[model samples]
Target: MAKPWFRVKRFGYGAGLPCAWQGWVVLAAHLALLIAASALLTGRPLPLSIVVITSTLGVVWIAWKTSDAPWRWRDGGED
Candidate 1:
């Protein structure tokens, strides 16, 4: 299998910072999308909301799929 782009957080219940260039690219793209959407969809509340929500879910999905391990509560202990 391919190496994961994100690593599980050591003290939380989710993925942490990017562990690969691909992950960084994904994060940057997501941010750019949100910014562009907000700027372009201003004054259109419905469309803005849709774009934000969809983009958020899409990013979460990508992180989960590319994470080094499944997300779960962590106490900073060795697995």
Candidate 2:
């Protein structure tokens, strides 16, 4: 059987935060860069795109932590 999307994201964690705020900071920066660049290049509504992407990453992080697969180091998929 194929691995589910949640399994593929198991390695998403890199830092251990003291609280949810810190965790969100890490996720926010990663997402902000992506959303900002995409918005600029595509001529989309920048602020709205940032907010939506940031929210989406937060939810994805939540689901990822709650999923059955164990947490693996976020190595950026590098060796």
Candidate 3:
């Protein structure tokens, strides 16, 4: 199988920072989209909310799919 782009967080219930360039690109693009959406959708609460929520879900889905391990609560113990 291909190497994962993200590593599971040691003390959280989700993926951590990017472990590969591809992951970094994904993160950067997501952030850029959010910023652009906020700037363009200012004063439009409904559209802004929809864009933010959809972008968030898209990022989460990408992270989950590219993570090295399944997400779960962690106490910093060896897995």
Candidate 4:
């Protein structure tokens, strides 16, 4: 029997969002942490933004490379 659409797996995870809801949620939390950590470490906003943006971009790139679907979409077949 075939698996249900929602139960299909992709991108090393059970696919949801293009980047996966799991990745977006994790990235959001990581950004929040980066904000706090950079602020505490540098006592400045510029470095905080820079670090957060860089890290966020890196994560986004990784998510994009690992995902098989387009942004905001999902696929059921392995790619």
Candidates in order have lDDT scores of 0.92, 0.54, 0.92, 0.56
Compose the digit string of candidate 2's lDDT tens values, residues 1-79: 1322333342465324324444456557657766677766575567667766777677567646544345666655653
TM-score of 1: 0.94
RMSD of each: 0.8, 11.5, 0.9, 8.3
Choose the strongest candidate by TM-score: 1
Candidate 3 C-alpha lDDT tens digits along 1-79: 3989999999979999999999999989989998999999989999999998998898899999999999999999999
Whole-model lDDT, candidate 3? Answer: 0.92
Which prediction has more favorable lDDT, 3 or 4? Answer: 3
TM-scores across all candidates?
0.94, 0.33, 0.93, 0.43
Candidates 1 and 4 compared by lDDT, better number: 1
Q: What are the per-residue Cα lDDT tens digits for candidate 1 across 1-79?
A: 4899999999979999999999999999999998999899889999999998998899889999999998999999998
Evaluation by lDDT, superior candidate among 2 and 4: 4
Residue 54 displacement (Å), model 3: 0.5
Which candidate, 1 or 4, has the higher TM-score? Answer: 1
1-79 per-residue lDDT for model 4 (tens digits): 1221122244344334433465666667776888677768686777777777777777666565554444442344544
In candidate 3, position 17 carries an lDDT of 93
Runs of candidate 1 with Cα error greater than 4 angstroms are none
Residue 42 Cα positional deviation in candidate 3, in Å, after optimal superposition: 1.1
Candidate 1 scores a C-alpha RMSD against the true structure in Å of 0.8
